[model samples]
Target: MRMSLDLQHLGREEEALQVAEAALTDPWVRHGDRLALQRRVLRLGKPPRRWRRPPWAASAQAEPREVVVSATMIKGAAGFKSCFVVPPARNGSGGGGGGGGGATGVPRTACVEELALLHYGSPAGGGWRGVHSEGGVWTTLWALLCWDVLFMDVPEVFRSPFQTAPLDLDTDAFLPARREAVDARLQLIASGGAPDLIRAVWSRRVGTWCRGVNWERLTLDDLLQIAGCVGGLGLSVVCRLLCEDAGGWRGGMPDLLLWRPERGDAMVSEVKGPRDRLSDQQRAWLAALSAAGVRAEVLRVVEAPPPPPLPPPPRPCAECRPAEDGGTQQGTVTTSARSCTAGGKARRRRGAHVCGRRAMAVPIVCEGTEGVTGGCTTDGTGEGAVVAAASVAVEAHSGMEDDRVVINDDDDDGSGGGGEEDQQQLQ
Candidate 1:
């Protein structure tokens, strides 16, 4: 009985009732305790009305819930689940009349066997098998589903082969055919009569293709290759960096153009390369496009292997020296010889220093001889008689005065006065 009460407190109402009933049958419990246990079991059986109605219960009833499934989920449920395939509607007048209303619709079986023949080798089937056979299957199925849903003609359905292949895949043969088919389909869509299903399928294929290519670091050559892959579709490829002169109305270039003649529609594209080492010219072109209100982008490409580092510069000659003017000075004699041998015109100027030595003559003047007083003359014919006789006399007189002043000093003043007078008389 106590155990039953404990179970009821623990919120195990079912277990508590079972334990209570079992305790009532047991002989060990007294009658009064059994009656009390029965009362507790009854209380447990009827929980508070507020507790019975939980807030979660109300929310679960009110809120609408959704289930999200991925591609993997769809693949997992592929066999178990079935889709209703609605056949093309026939004319208004039909032989068959509606009878069973609750009957299940006919199940659709995928025509996988016919897919290889329709898409494998045909020009309409983009050579996607080389890159992604499974992806191709999905893309092709999507295209066909769109055509059937929209009641589009068979020609409009398989137009334009899907050209873009995975980078890791070899698509040499498939790419060209795929491009043609894709273009044809695109043209049909542009005709303004394509159903929404066709548009949706094309959109998915295009998105997949764009995702597959590593657009960054795509080189100009690579862009040209891509253009070639889509060339048959009437696309004109141009580098946005290139200048265009439209009858003197100069303008920056547009990257890519896909024009359709039938619909008079066009698609403009802007191609970009890796950001690393983008040249000034490329940047300017991008800026120009932005200024012109054109859409543009920057993409990255795989870095190519670097070339070998250039060999270290040759060591300078040991004998080489810089000139006093801080210029490189070579051997002067060698330089001069080379200059002369080269037949350079020689320049002449006054007071120019000569390199070789030569003897030079200079004039000298001789004074009068010793003790030769006035009136001593030189014969003009003699080599030694260059000075005039009067000039020689004046020079002799000046010399006598100079000698008297020195020789007749204070030591022999009185005697020198008489001697000086005699000398004067003699002079």
Candidate 2:
């Protein structure tokens, strides 16, 4: 190929054409490569007055690359579960008709016979094989289900054929054929003059899914939009797997077929996350698509809205730190327990000091011990009564312990300062 290019560059058009044509006969040359050689032959053998290069011949750098994210990773932080093929399917949550649950993952592209993908199906023998009769048993929900429409488009090159799309194919790139097949099915559905079959199908299935569709109005615009979407998949696949019917592949595909007016294209999307995952059938379908050269993507718009910002953690009260006299710094008491300064030093009189300025202890709030559990016993008299406080305590190597704090119920008729004193003797 390089030699052919060199020949063409040196103005030896006949020689370049021969060299390029010779390379085309190689059995190892890929289909895309074959097309490249054929184009070169056309260029060198007979250069047109105004030779125009098709997109495939141009450098790859000219096009913008799209980024596809992981759907399994973006499910709700609290609860995330991959999709499984649940029996009695119809596995979407919203749209009109209850498009089953959020488990509806992607389009109907891959053929599901070889493998069981993770986060896409039950790990054991549950997926596609049995019915999930218990609804609450599966706790995982895909967050993608939250959107009304999951929309993304297939690049044009992959939608139709690069050049030679075969009619009959298996495990090969044949979207052109698939498109034909879809159109055929739609034609069958609209055979009785159903007012333009393709348009009618889209009008009924696209927007008001999981609920009900307006069967009255169908249009050609919708059919074209849908045909371009599904990453180049055919409409027969979409109708069979996506549309709502009692016996449809309702439990297997995405919920909606969306159109992006700005790009003038359509996309197949499964709105997820009532809470996330593509079902096994979906995974298989995607696998089959990738094998066939179609681009399948998991488009995550953003990261779950950053989990609502976490509530900022609780702040501690100001008086819980240790104090100079073996008590809380601000002297805060917990529960019905009382606290007052009772340091065994020269008692600072109510308003007396050597400098004629009295020093006072900082006041602390009394917060009761919360988890201490025990029955309380009260004497008939209010003051000067026997009050035995038995608090529930939990030890590192023990059961609930009742620690008693007994008070003679001494009366302080004059001031409240001495009413609840920090009696170190209670410890």
Candidate 3:
């Protein structure tokens, strides 16, 4: 039985299946021989019971709970896979292991946190800085979401804000004002202030939270869902600003500018309302803006909501192997010693597997203050010994070619502070 299991683990599924199936055909077996053998060998049985929906499923008020459940389930699956496949090691014991040493040693969480820092930190120079305003929050949210999706990182901090115990808006006037202040700060940064405000917020909120979270546990779809939430907020603001019915500018607020800095112009004017019901004055303003390089237009926010949830991901395909005769085959199969020899020929005919290809090598040149001091070839196979030897040879040759090379002015200063004595020794 152990031998058969080993064969299955080695991807010889067909051989294991044959061994198990053959055992059931033995004449010594009783009336339930086949079923008993299958139970013992393959562990075949009825599937487990399906999960029951929570009681809140029937109420429209339960939507938030449902969304939480959906997001949790999706992210949980990824987290489970990450933990199971790449469990944290005990100190540095596993550090020196070679290939196929359980799992790759890459630190998934650290990579994600670095990516998030880069995304938020890049916009710190010239543009906006001040207290957060509604508009500024929306802008930052949109940019963060877009960069998050484009770069493919956890974006979990954004989702974390929504999951925190729901805010009591009525009791907490400061909560709304806090969001507004955040927006105003972003506006100041956008207008011209340094990114210090953004850096401060990230250090206080995002950086602190991310330090403890393992980002590798989050999936691509989880990040996308967060982005969708941010995008929805942006869409809400855009709709409100474009559809307002007040004709003349009663407030000191400047006309809404649908600016597209990427395109070097304003794309549209949103007078918040019905497209066909635009007043004559509003229409004239839109026409004038359009002619003057601003593409002005208004769009109404419809009352209809979006569609239902998407289906869960499909299950992985069953493991299988090809027959020795070059014929298609299904199910896990273990090859017999005779069949193994035949399969070798068949594999050769099919061409070398992708994993066999040697990666190309590239030469890297190291430059110092003195000049291009050395060069080394890095073979894509990741053999550090070879790289080190090449690097040493290059350095040795470079040093021999120019024995008097002075790489830095700091090297001239001796710790003893005897500058004249050092100079005399060099001469």
Highest TM-score, which number? 2
Against the reference, the lDDT scores of all candidates come to 0.29, 0.32, 0.27
User: What tens digits encode model 3's per-residue C-alpha lDDT throughout 1-427?
Assistant: 4555677789876676557657666753322223334443433212232144323223211111000000001123533321111113211112110101232444333221112122112232111111112133323332232222212222222334433211221122322334444354435534433233333443454522221132233233332332232233333333222222111211112123222222233233232211124443344344433433333444332222335799985432222223454433322121111111111100101111111222222222122122212321232221221222211111111112221221111342222121221111100
**Each model's backbone clash number:** 16, 31, 40
- Is 2 or 3 the stronger prediction by lDDT? 2
**Candidate 3: where is the Cα deviation over 4 Å?**
1-166, 169-172, 175-191, 194-296, 299-427
Task: Give lDDT tens digits, candidate 2, residues 1-427.
Answer: 7889898789887788778768877865533345557666656654553255445453311221222222212223444343323222222322221111343554321111111121122323112211111111000010011111211122342344332212221222323324555455445432322224434444454443222232223234433433333223333333333221212222343333333333444332333332245544444333333333333333222222233566765433334334554434332223232322221111111211112222333222222112212211232122221233333221110111322233322444312243454332222
Question: How accurate locally is residue 255 in candidate 1, as Cα lDDT from 0 to 100?
Answer: 33
Q: How far is candidate 2 from the true structure (C-alpha RMSD, Å)?
A: 20.0
Candidate 3 or 1, higher lDDT: 1
Candidate 2 ranges with C-alpha deviation above 4 Å: 1-224, 228-233, 236-248, 269-277, 288-295, 299-427
Q: What's the TM-score of each model vs. the native?
A: 0.14, 0.23, 0.16
Task: Give per-residue lDDT, candidate 2, residue 267.
Answer: 31
RMSD vs true structure, all candidates: 37.6, 20.0, 34.3
